[model samples]
Structure formats: C-alpha cells, structure tokens
Target: MSKQVIALAYDGRNAPSVTAKGDDALAEAILAIAREHEVPIYENAELVRLLARLELGDAIPEALYRSIAEVIAFAWYLKGKAPVGFGQRDDGDAPLLLSGPER
Candidate 1:
C-alpha cells in the first residue's frame, strides 16, 4: 500500500474535522509539518485507510467516534492535558490508563 497521512482537529465542543490528507509525497509533507509543529503522531495503517476516505474539512462520521476518541485521548494524555473538570473534584479520582505504544 502507498504511504498515506491524515490530520484531524477537534474542538471540545464540536466533532473532529479532517484538516489534511495525502498520499506519497504529499503525505511526507503533511508529516513534516506535523513534526515541525510538535503535534502528536499516531500510526495506524487501518485507521489511515478509513480516514483517507474523508474530505478535507469534513467532520468525522459517527461510526468513527470511538476510534477517533481513543486517539485524541491518547494525544491529550501525552501532552499532560485533561478535559475541563476532569479529575478536578475529590470524588473524581479516576486514573487515566496509559498503555504501551501501538505498533
């Protein structure tokens, strides 16, 4: 399969949107920009195949909510960020489960 890359952006209040997508050389450029910006990179060939189907500026479909959420959550964890009010109260002491890197 040819190399591919997809980039997404999400605001807490709205669904995530596809900000970029490309194959081969364009894919390399996208990855380079992301690396320059220090954005987290997660590699999943299967997920890339699915996301590459989306148009630029398109919000992620409902069917992908869970998968996308997991990726976003992991990125947040890597950046040491938590959702607003998450684990803020004494009663909400749930620990975030960070797992081994996915291949």
Candidate 2:
C-alpha cells in the first residue's frame, strides 16, 4: 500500500512557509538539502503576500529570510522514506497493539 503523505504549512512572521507533509525535522532537512544543491525554490502564499507589501527591488528582512531557510530545510528532509508515526507499520498498515485492555 502507498503511504499517506501530509502537507505542512509554516506560520512565520513574514512568509507563510509551506512544505510537503512529513516528519518536521525531515521536511526541513529536505528543503535545506535542496537549497544546498542550488535548486530553485518557490514562494508560498504567505511569502508572496509579504513580498507584495515591499517596494519593487526591496531586500527581504533578515528574520524573514532565516524563517524561510528553516522551512525550506524541513521540506528537503521529506524526500526520503521517513516514517510519520511512532511504532507504526512501515508499509502504511495500522500499528499492532502490544497490550490492550478495558479499564
């Protein structure tokens, strides 16, 4: 069976960072790796909005750039086979119960 993938959104002051849904760290790492590889990145809605507020040819703020970088890194890590939940089946099956009982 295919695995369930989620879409992640980053809520920062400037750009609203969006990434492929996956483990937080993994996704960020993926984005970072992509950046390191010199891949072009696109801006999400939030980022566009923020950029729109600036004058043409204006430089982005440092804080906002840092936030964008972090979110991008996360997106990079998601490209690999990273598991979402703990103790769950890797094949996209439900987790097996080790112990269960009614209270």
Best by TM-score: 1
Q: What TM-score would each prediction reach against the true structure?
A: 0.81, 0.27
lDDT of 1 by residue, 6-103 (tens): 88887776788888888877777777787787677887778777877889889889999999889888877776766777863221221111111222
Q: What is the per-residue lDDT of model 2 for residues 5-102, given as tens digits with 9 covering 90 to 100? A: 22223332334323333234544554566467544445354544444344423444565776545544454444332244544334331111011111
Measured with C-alpha atoms, the lDDT of residue 40 in candidate 2 is 40
Model 2, position 78, has a per-residue lDDT of: 43
Question: Top model by lDDT, which number?
Answer: 1
